[model samples]
Target chain A: MNESSLPFFARGMDPGPSFVDVLRRLAPHGVAGSGAPDHGSALIDTVHGTTVVAIRFASGVIMAGDRRATSGMSIASRRIEKVFAADDFSGIGIAGAAGPAVELVKLFQVQLEHYEKIEGEGLSLDGKANQLGGMVRANLPAAMQGLVVVPLFAGYDERRGIGRVFSYDVTGGKYEEADFQTNGSGGVHARNWIKATWRDDMTRDEAIDLALRSLFAAADEDAATGGPDLVRRIFPTVAVIDTDGFTSVSDDEIATRAEALLGGREEGAGL
Target chain B: MTMPFYVSPEQVMKDRADYARKGIARGRSLVAISATDGIVIVAENPSRTLYKISEIYDRIAFAGVGKYNEFEMLRIAGVRQADVKGYSFAREDVNARALANAYAQTLGQIFTHEMKPYEVEILVAQLGETPDDDELFHILYDGTVMDEEGFTVLGGLSEQVHESLGATYKPPIDRATAVRLGAAALTPADQAPLNAGALEVAYLDRARARRAFQRLKGPELDAVLAG
Candidate 1:
């Protein structure tokens, strides 16, 4: 709060390049997750986001998430974006409690940008994953109260010239996936779908189609997940992270693909 | 009992100003010019790792001349202040004027209270939607700030650089011309013009989306210099 003095930390108390640490130091209560729970049986049916998937291909990684949030078997939001670019090189797809999950994504974005500005370079892919792990671990108290948030991180590691994917548990346990990973109420279904079709040499277009199909399969089985809505003209959000950088696939392209895929399914069912 | 000689307030202030000026005069010069694309900053720095110009916020940039360690410390502090403010409030609320005032207050306090004043002069530039909206603030070691127009220069040889830059001080020029003008102004009259390898260049490109600050180095720097 003191604007005159420089925000210099003592050698022992320095936060270094961690922006989350700076926030924690400034406002201890704000970054401690939502609030204290009453520890009662009556659970809060907070809005929950569902079904995000990431797949690695030859050139880079493609991430996709449904635009649906659920609250006690009802649709809370039909157009909620769950996947976001953490920085230029990495993409993050979040699931679980919508409020805390979105907040965590915002914080993660600022953390990466802040560290890059202060340190004059971005963190390594592994370093960024570890930073997100620490943040998820810090949210343990809220996660215990049924407000869990698990995010899947994927990036094009320029150093190794390969795309990598990482997934996290509620307790902040991080695990690197070899090819693809998924999370949310329909994670298992989507993972099964991707596991069957995912190949090591998948092209960008193939990976994108596979991701959309997996989300479609998940939505068919899970009430929380929403499928592509043709009436509303709403399609799943998709993004690609490559050596060039992170880019969102346009809605027009995704809509076309969704229609084509749906037409094939409709014809097969008619038989 | 040892009795200290009482010095006049004016004399003490004058001596501190002179000392600070001498220290600043020993460093290489830096120039910043407002252009059509963005604001270009060029410094006669050979070291690639140690930056003389840096980003402070989404649309703001900071450049300093004088003691490297002192300016580097100030650069880091400015970044912290800007980042913290942006995080606490909305990103649009963070501006160059507030940051410049903070730097002034700190420098003024040190100039009067500390035994020795910091030997650094800094520039804070903010990119606007239009060329006329661009803001550049030049802050001296004694905490005096000047609202510069179009372009500003800092360092021991600022007077010479200013004169050289003024001859071709046209607003809304292209980025390459702005860089060339800045590099020309920073170079001494008797010496050959500086090349990309010996200069550090950066700009707050208005064409960018959020964070506008970008450094020009290696092949990119060479291409710009050639342009």
Candidate 2:
């Protein structure tokens, strides 16, 4: 029964699909799948992130990302989707490469579901964050090629019955943010907004508004961050990760929030 | 070669087939059908966990009866193949025919090469985007495959179940009707009818997303059977 002697496949057998196997199978050739090349990948790529912020409210966690995606001095996309569903119980906000970052989120999502199905049990919140760290570390070679992906993962832990957040670097340095944290180009501006408005016991409404204001402030200062578009009807993606699951704030509600924010309401309200 | 009496190949094949059929006949039968809502699988198993019908992939489902361990292995293989193919190519490309063919090959190989043939009959059901394309591919113990359009049955007492299901089965039936049809097929009319608790049921819902696989349990299953 000892781990040292069992063959790889036999030891790894579970009801759900294997996440590592999927990663290995999906990685590009020898680049991201296995071996030492990916071993230190999280460190190799030094893609500087702008901002990512997470806030804890009465219900769960509120996560918001800017609409802009930047590469070097150029704005890659004005409406690049940065927030993604990690699972029903979680959501992830990425601030690195427009490509690999998104791919990493998708893989994370599949890994969770696959694990849930095969093992008949969901991985712990900490386990999921670590899995992301491993994936980041695995992408070292590609990260060196200017394809770095740094992501902020936030989710509601069903077992703990509370929302949790984790931030990662290109080299897979994972840190659990206790109160709040932000990453990316406009992260400084965004984080300041949260730091000022975030309260000790903010309700879900206050947290959401706080999250929106932070993103608005980020968009106001950084050209790389796109503010809410009244014409195209696009807004920064927002989601709530709570005890229930991850639910994206509907576009209609986002539009309303944007309208209210722009309608003479002072930008900085709460301390 | 042993200097002993040689048995004919025909005898060998016959013995293997009988062994497989007899083993298969000892278990319960399951019915797979393309319903209006989606594809339904009804297995006559008392134990809920030891399911004869299970998900192979997002769009594909597997149902088998006979030796539990043997069919369970095949179920895992089907899952691996489907997952591998889907990951490599597009999800839509993982069709019923491809899975059925793979099962046929493996089952055929085992039937001939191994001393014992797998005493199992399995079904590969896929709910296509359209009703016309929804297919139920049944694979028997001896590597025989049947491309069923509307409905089909497999495992022990198949002759009786299939005959019963065939009479009431209609193309593009609704979800509840399909469930009732499946239960009827597996139940002995001469005895008491099976209630929802006695039957194991799941469906490949067409109305859902890419992955149609879903289990019908608890009150929802009760409602369906009641209807």
Candidate 3:
């Protein structure tokens, strides 16, 4: 559909109809309907939480998330992507139902970028966080039946001229992180690891290395957390946001960094 | 009961049009174009926070002139629609024409059903990966939808500005030429020429992403206008 909507004239159409409305319009009882589906039902899908960590640096912020998805006790996906660019200036990571969680983040990303495009500016960080909260809250009924979703959001606000990070609960409670934050089953381990290694005004390199270490520690302990897979050449996703904009480090670059992080740790332990 | 005062429908319509026009004429104007570098929009706005242009979809952009709050509401509404559409359907399905029609529908509704017509005019821009794919749609306060070929001028004195732009709008102008054209198009024949200091610029750069809307101000704008 070339120039499908020509949105300047598309003002009368209410922000694309709501998903629930779409379901109601297309088929009243279609899949993704209102009720919480039964757990362990054939429709029940496994969820995986990739390790994601955000660290505040002297100049801006560094964010990283692993690329693994586990279903129940099985490695459901080894290369499931979790990190996404929410908009030009921000990033988001997902944990929980791999399917719906990814879906929510995708919608959230589109919503933020969409707002920026339509409104000529993005929602404030607080506004963005609230927007995500509202989306998660909308999924409350689904969450009751093992469809929980949690997300981490971070961005470089041009107005504030600084980097900020936010975390979410299954019920959409948004909490701003002061320095660094992590999410998923391995979150606690990752948070503590970062606490031990983090400092105010750290350089970008130090921030990235510390973020990598925190994720590794989390992966070493949490079943849901995935560390660097050297044999397969799979590594975590990392992004940096400065005054310029949001840019993710290449997978190859991240693999190199992860390899060095592991090597240094092994050497320090004399292993 | 006293008979309704003899007021012709034409007179009443003319009065409403005058009021809408007056409100819109007081605001700064903006110009937009589809160039080889992508879609460029230039506005004579001084506020860094208050923007006259924005992105509404992966490839669609929104530019409004007149009351900021009124246009901003429309902008938010467009965002909601585009985001929802992209979620329910595919990104490629969201286009400029459908959105332009929707805006027309809403503006028509407001013009007829609402207490007051929206005192604003808007432009929707889209950049294609290829030259033939680009689009520009200008929607008026009365829900008038016009497909702008290559370039269009918006806001107050648009007629005069369009006359100035003339047929000389060089097709597939580079970004630099597009910026010069837009800035020139907004300049009045009697007023002093506009420079970077008096203009706010942005572009739908057709970058390697779903959303390509970006605002260019400050030194980046300074460098562009200086040339």
Candidate 4:
């Protein structure tokens, strides 16, 4: 709160438009650091679970994540949110260690806003993806301690006039996926499901259905992932980013889609 | 070593104030007015890249005149302060009042203690949910703070601009009218009206979500001026 009280000379040596750098210089511990001891031995004891998928379509991109966080054989949280708005035109979905993943998302959000505020313009989509890569790289220390966080970043690239998807490794290696990407415990299942159904030039409805079906398939096979809970009305979080901006799908719509999918599965079993 | 001749405290302060004032007077003027929906800032700046008005937070905006380097430093400091505060606390808690006070403290300290005072005049404007809550804090070169309602002008020829603005300014003005009024005030009586390209305009619209600060430029600026 009293950040302005820093000496005039120090203020003059501003870290030049990077909020993360400024935080690192002023509050070193706040930015991801390497001091924490490794928890690799008991990694399963900590909260870990996810199935987040991002698919690029004709208009833009669709990002969806199931609401589940588990520790070992126990469910830690049932309605945990994993998808967040990176900015107006971008979205991020996290999977891996819940605590560190959420922290990384918060930091990424701040970094983008900070850059925009200081530079008087938002960074290009490429610049934003690269920035996230740097943050993930910095979090390498935490990742080595079994607190790995892999996030899926998707956004409507205004300059390129299309939606783009970028996935990352534990050490901040960024890979631009041509079609779709998935992360978390059930990522493999979700990825296979998406590969079978995904098609270029798909409409928004088809893309949404594909995202929901992939998440459903992941939840069906992966014990850590949670499926839609009809009694509790908990559905996967889905966000659509396109030319207009980023908008999250409503829970009612998701429920409707989940019900239809369930009905089709029942009929197929009977047949 | 001979003893240095002692200058009176009042004389030293006066000299510093005069020096600061002269540096400020060499620059063009800027204005901020409370509009029907939010706050609008207009500056007679020809450079498209060098901004004189900018956003400091979601609801707060900053405008500076006098020295570009000095004011830009202040602008960046304000942004840092706001961002840090919002990060530490809630975003709603980052208001203009605290930022203006911080600027005053720094400018005042430098004016009296530093070898050379900073030559800058800055305004911190926060758009409230309602027109009655809008605030315009004008901080002068010597760290003098003025909490003005309705409108305020800063920099060289401020008195003339103030008079022109006061004569035409009315509460609850629309965005286009506010821009025209500010443009008229910044223009000298003998000179023709300024075109959109020569002016820098920004607004903190209350209706805007989260971040309210937006620049009006190119065709948007031309359209507003034409309107």
Candidate 5:
């Protein structure tokens, strides 16, 4: 953003491969918390996205998120996408303050790419998670102003040849989730559903179905979490990160799955 | 005190320019050709770990042919500039012209003010929606920037390679043909032919989503050349 000069730093003073570090050196107050709202005074009812979940299957990881952003008791939006591909092999799911959450995802994506280009190789899975952690830590000032952002990170680790998921706290503490992880207002309900149905050797289709079902269950319990809106044909956004790469499940397919899921529930309720 | 001899500014500049040119002339050459899909870049480099071409942004790519360290520094700076700009504004806002101008300013400043000029000749290529919109910028060590059409060459053998490439290149070429042409042009007349392993190839594919730059190596490189 600084006018047209190449960002060449002196020896030992370089930001290395970190894009955030470069931002700090060039413009100390450029990124997060720049113009954050004051902490007190009945914090603004900014839009808040909710309920994103990640489940690890045999081959890789599948992340799914409901399409809802609630401002106080009102639905601010019905098609807010929470799940995003962090890179070719990884994905991110966001929750909390909608504005800052989306911004964090954008910044995080740039961070991964920036490091990859500068270092001539991508960061290790663990390293990517830690990098996101540091970014979350940087957002602490903004988080305190009632714009807390908690994100779930999942990726297919090339070295380990398995899917990995990481969850973070507001304080930037990162924890690896072995089987699965869920976050946001409906996180508990979704996690409960996943814990009941998830298995070690589930196929890709099974994993995707389980992810959709978990979001459905969360939506049933949490008002902020949106269920499949058949009238609008809006379904939860889903993405799978595998050895091949990150691929999003198409909306048409998700719509069919949502319809089938509801039909099965209807039959069970009748029974 | 002993009298100190003074050197004229013009002579000093000429000396610096010559030194930089000599340093650049010792390195291998690189070529970028515009094709239907994107711009293909081929460099005659044997070192697997070191890269002469790399992605700068979603659509922009940076390539340098000269002293590896000096060019590498320039490459990293270009990445930083493009990334920072994309972060601040929209990705589409970052363009080759702006990046080329920035590089020119930096090199010019160093050449005019510093004790020594950087021994690097760089290329910043941006893939356009159509073949005609594609842009190639060739920048010199002394901060001169040339907006090239169709194809551009960099490094010590640029004049010869450029001429050879111009003879064979045709517009709207496909990826495979572009790679072959670039490779053919990079090989000097007196030297033995370069194999796949001895060359580093990459392209900025407009058809690709998001980051468009991709490297051609190993089996892929072999396949393209063989084709």
Candidate 6:
């Protein structure tokens, strides 16, 4: 398609601020929920991602997701990324149907950038969360057809001078989590681990460790969630979003942490 | 039934062009200069909130001088177009030439067919990897597109401003020098020097990542102008 030209109107009827609204008006199908058709048959064989966790700490928020995609009883992909930067200061971790989940993240990223450029300012953290909720609501039709996409959004709230986390239901209901949130096939195990280890005033390092431990526990019990692969050098994606903005933790750091976790487990087994 | 008066097509075209030019000429002028770092645009806009320079895409920027509502409408349209195109194809595909052509088409169509032509002149600038690759397209109210080099000016008294810019136009200048030159050219002969507060500055610095457009205001603008 050609580049979009300026949209014209008589006067005062402009599609103000929202890029999604503009897309909805210009190309209805381009908007996420407006195009996906509902199917009768279940999409049971689709690639589904497991285990993603977000923890709010003293400085900001830590988002981590295991690098695995599963279809029914078999592994579909082992190095699938599930954590994405929604904007400079915000990120989203996906934990549901892999295809739709990735698409949702991409669309959300574009939506945020689009709004910022059009309005000449970034949206508030709350506004962004609500916007994600709206996108999820729009995906309800596909969600009903078993192509659900559930995401956890975390951002550093400039107004409040603190990090905030929001989790969404399949129907697009948003709930602001107080400390930490987790989702996916291994969500139960990961959530339990976080509940026992989470703290209100954890440091950045402690938050990262807790997230890694939670994912490790999830992978241990759930077949869909893959643990850190030493041979393949594949590790979970971990990102920190704070006042300085979103930055992905290096693979070496993650590997070192995973190795330490495994060494501790080995010591426990010996005992 | 009374017959409508026969107006010659030349007369009608001239009238529309004249009307559009008058509307545009009422606004203050702006200029875009290709610099060593990237492209620098300086406009004589005092209002901080109402911008005349904005990003259109990753490497493309849009600048306009004319009716506020009219140019702003064009700006939003350009944003929508670039975003949608980038979304559909790859990001690199959304360039200034394509956007310039699109603007020309829209403006030209409106100028010829509509009862009231849009009173706006716009610039679509794309900063390339090197100084040689930078593109500057100056589009007119009647959809005339000029692929400019070194520097281009827009809005009222553009001829005088263009001459001023042409006299001092030099390639591969630094950011500060480009801003100073543009500010000098924008200032009228009889008027005092335009201060930082009276100017709006933005640039597509190649050193910047993906989105290259940036605004220089307040102290930063002052620093650049002082240099």
Candidate 4: tens digits of C-alpha lDDT, residues A102-175: 87888888889989988989999999999999989988877787878889999999998899999999889999
- Model 5 agreement with the true structure over B1-227: per-residue lDDT tens digits: 99979999899999999999999999989999999999999999998999999989999999998888888998888888888888887888889999999999999999999988999999999999998999999999999999999999999988999999999997879989999998888888887768898999999987887889999899988988988
lDDT of each: 0.89, 0.77, 0.77, 0.88, 0.90, 0.89
DockQ of 4: 0.43
- Model 6 ranges off by over 4 Å: A1-6, A9-14, A34-39, A265-271, B1-4
Tens digit of per-residue lDDT, candidate 1, span A1-271: 7756657677788787888777777655557474647475328689999999999999999999999999987899999999999999999999999888888988898889888888988999999999999889988888887788899999999899988999999889999999999999998999999999889999999999999999999998998998989899999999999999899999999999888888888653511
Minimum summed lDDT over a 10-residue window in model 1 chain A is located at A33-42
**Residues B110-177 of candidate 6: C-alpha lDDT, one tens digit per residue:** 99999899999999999988878999999999999999877899999999999998988877688889
The better-scoring model by DockQ among 2 and 6 is 6
Q: Which residue pairs does candidate 5 place in steric collision?
A: none
Candidate 2 chain A weakest lDDT stretch, 10 residues: A1-10
Order of candidates by DockQ, top first?
Answer: 5, 1, 6, 4, 3, 2
What C-alpha lDDT, on a 0 to 100 scale, does residue B130 get in candidate 1?
79
Model 3 RMSD in Å is: 5.2
lDDT of 5 at B126: 94
User: What TM value does the first chain of each candidate achieve?
Assistant: 0.95, 0.82, 0.85, 0.93, 0.95, 0.94
Worst 10 residues of 5 chain A by lDDT: A33-42
**Isolated chain B TM-score per model:** 0.97, 0.96, 0.93, 0.98, 0.97, 0.98
> Candidate 2: what lDDT?
0.77
Question: What stretches of model 1 exceed 4 Å from their correct place?
Answer: A2-6, A32-42, A267-271
Q: Look at candidate 4 and give me any clashing residue pairs.
A: none
User: What lDDT tens digits, residue by residue, belong to model 2 across residues A1-271?
Assistant: 1111111244345433665574353333422333324333343323233456778776789888867766667656667777888877777888766666766776676677667555445688888888889888877666676666788888887888777888888888899988787878788888887887778788777887788888888877887777777788888888888866878888888888867877756543321
Measured on C-alpha atoms, candidate 1 has an lDDT of 0.89
- The true-versus-predicted C-alpha distance at residue B112 of model 5, in Å, is 1.0
Q: Can you give the lDDT of residue A134 in candidate 3?
A: 82
